[model samples]
Target: MTDIIEAIERVNGVLVDLSLEAFENDWQRQWLVERGVEIISEASRHLPDDLKARNPEIPWQKVAGIGNVLRHNYENIAAAVLWKLAQADLSTLEKACRSELAAEQSRGRR
Candidate 1:
């Protein structure tokens, strides 16, 4: 929810200016993005199924699995993968989060 949206914004903010070459070389930026993904991954697990159903495009299982990767197999993650995710995949996820939040607010109003 809000956590996921905020984390994505934080990560996207960090990456909005950097290129793949720069992202690969900057360990600090990579760490920040990884941390954000970890937050998104953990928060995603608690999302309601009905909310998830509305955005079937998101790879919800992979979203959860990434936290495990960050925790247990940290060495396996590459900078390129992180760059691609931040640049390409995160917007879709962020959009889903916003959509879910809006839907929840609409339901609350009713």
Candidate 2:
């Protein structure tokens, strides 16, 4: 669980470092986006199957998709698409991560 939380934190840090407006259009921020996608993919790999299966609400596929785009279609990946994803999708992903972390903490308390 700590590993998962740490992964989420790492991703959040990258997003913060890149900053909102910069991430929207700056091609220089591409490396950070690539790294963030990798981090999220790695984190997804560690998630429990039960947790993933029961909670179909999470966007695990999207996280993995980022890795795919960064790895395979690096050249073809569109900045505008990435920007839209950052603006529209990241908040949902962040909330999901926080929710999972909170659930883990509550379980530990019990």
Candidate 3:
């Protein structure tokens, strides 16, 4: 759970600096978009199965798959798609992570 939170935080941090203009710059694409996806993927892998099941709205497998593609299919990845993910999809994931973390904290207090 802590790992997931940290991962989500890392992703959010990367996203803060990303923009569609980043696609025009190789360094930003690698460091921000690609790396952010890698972090999310790795963090998603650590999530407990039940926790993942609880958030069916998130495409957990697809999130993990992005990590795989980044790692293995780097040359084939489309900059436009990566840009879209960084700009749009990650917010949904971040919201889900924050919600789960809040729920977990509340449960711990009881």
Candidate 4:
């Protein structure tokens, strides 16, 4: 659980540092967008099903699927889509991860 939270936090931090403008350059797209997706995909793969179940809003399957796409079909991936996902979609997952961490901490203190 802590590992999941930590992973999410790390990805969130990386996403925070990125911007859509970075996708304009081919190198930036490969380094930032592609690598970021790879990191998130690996992190998401390690997340427990029980924890994932708690966050209904997140498309857990799609999250995992993106990783597969990036890994298997790297050439087909769109930088703009990845950029959109990083800027918009990730915040929801990050918020859910933080909420779960807070709930866990509260339970621990009790």
lDDT of 1 by residue, 4-109 (tens): 9999999989998789999999999999999999999999999999888889999999999999998999889999999988888999999988987897899999
Ordered from best to worst TM-score, the candidate numbers read 1, 3, 4, 2
Highest-scoring model, lDDT: 1
Candidate number with the higher TM-score (1 or 4) = 1
Estimate, for each residue in 27-48, the C-alpha lDDT of model 4 and write its tens digit.
5445555666667767787887
Which portions of model 1 show Cα errors greater than 4 Å? none
Query: What TM-score, over all chains together, does every model reach?
Result: 0.95, 0.71, 0.81, 0.76
For each candidate in the order shown, give its overall lDDT on alpha carbons.
0.93, 0.66, 0.75, 0.71
lDDT for model 1:
0.93
Consecutive 10-residue window with the lowest summed lDDT within model 4: 1-10
Report the alpha-carbon TM-score of model 2 versus the true structure.
0.71
Tell me how candidate 3 scores on lDDT. Answer: 0.75
* Native-to-model Cα distance after best TM-score fit, residue 50 in candidate 1, in Å: 1.3
lDDT string for model 3 (1-109, tens) is 5555566566566656656565456666355657767877887888989988988998999998888889998888777777677667877888888888899899999
Q: What global local distance difference test value does model 4 have?
A: 0.71
State the lDDT at 55 in candidate 2. Answer: 58
lDDT for position 49 in model 1: 92
The 10 consecutive residues of candidate 1 with the worst lDDT sum are 95-104
Q: Write the per-residue lDDT of candidate 2 for residues 1-110, one digit (tens) a residue.
A: 45445655554565665655676567667566566656677677778887677557767777666777778778887766665665566666667667877888899999
